[model samples]
Target: MILYYALLIIDPSLIGIFINPFIVQFTIFTRVYFIACLLGVLIPGILFAIRSIKSDKPEINLQGKLLLIAFISFTIGALLTSSIPQMTIKVIARLILVTSSLEFYMGYLLPNWVKKILLKNDN
Candidate 1:
């Protein structure tokens, strides 16, 4: 991942940039990066989440659900932002991306307040 970012920094055009609302272009590098993300990040995350969800512990199940939502939302947001040219769609996609971060944090950290709310329902 570090090496990939380094290459991106060396050549910014590898990912291509939006010049206008109606114009969108993606370079081969961008496709490769997308595929790398899917394989390296999303797939592992989903597998972990599923395993966690299958555990008997309620806390683990909640965490797994949160992680699953986070990964799915992140993928959707990334896909929308990359493919869609409209400004409104971009804004919505950014919001989804932000929510995914929050979900991931909650899943990883399992804050006490969130645990109380979510796990309480199991009783």
Candidate 2:
């Protein structure tokens, strides 16, 4: 994967073509990369989140849920950004990407304020 990405960085035209100044059509290599990411990262992440959610600890469960949301939102955002041509839809996708980043941060760190608010709701 690293080699493939490196090659792409060195010569983007080897796998991709610019539709216009702003848009690049998806290529076979790009599709393969997306598939690799989905299988390698997203699927495993979702599985881990599910396992965590099933744990006995409330904190773990909350973290799992947040992580799950983050993963799902990130996927949605990426797909929307790549597939849609409209600028407006792209903006919405970027917002979802930002939300996913925030969710991932909260899940990984579980800050005191977030923990208090989330745990308070459970009680």
The most accurate candidate by TM-score is: 2
Give each model's whole-structure lDDT: 0.86, 0.85
TM-score of each: 0.80, 0.82
Candidate 2 lDDT, 1-123, residue by residue in tens: 786778789998866777876566777778677767766768988998999899898889999999999999998898887777777898899999999999999988899899988886643
* lDDT (10s digit) by residue, model 1, range 25-91: 7777777778677667889999999999999998899999999999999998988887777889989
What TM-score number comes out for model 1? 0.80
RMSD of each: 3.3, 2.5
- Candidate 2 has its poorest 10 consecutive residues by lDDT at 20-29
Q: Worst lDDT window (10 residues) for model 1?
A: 15-24
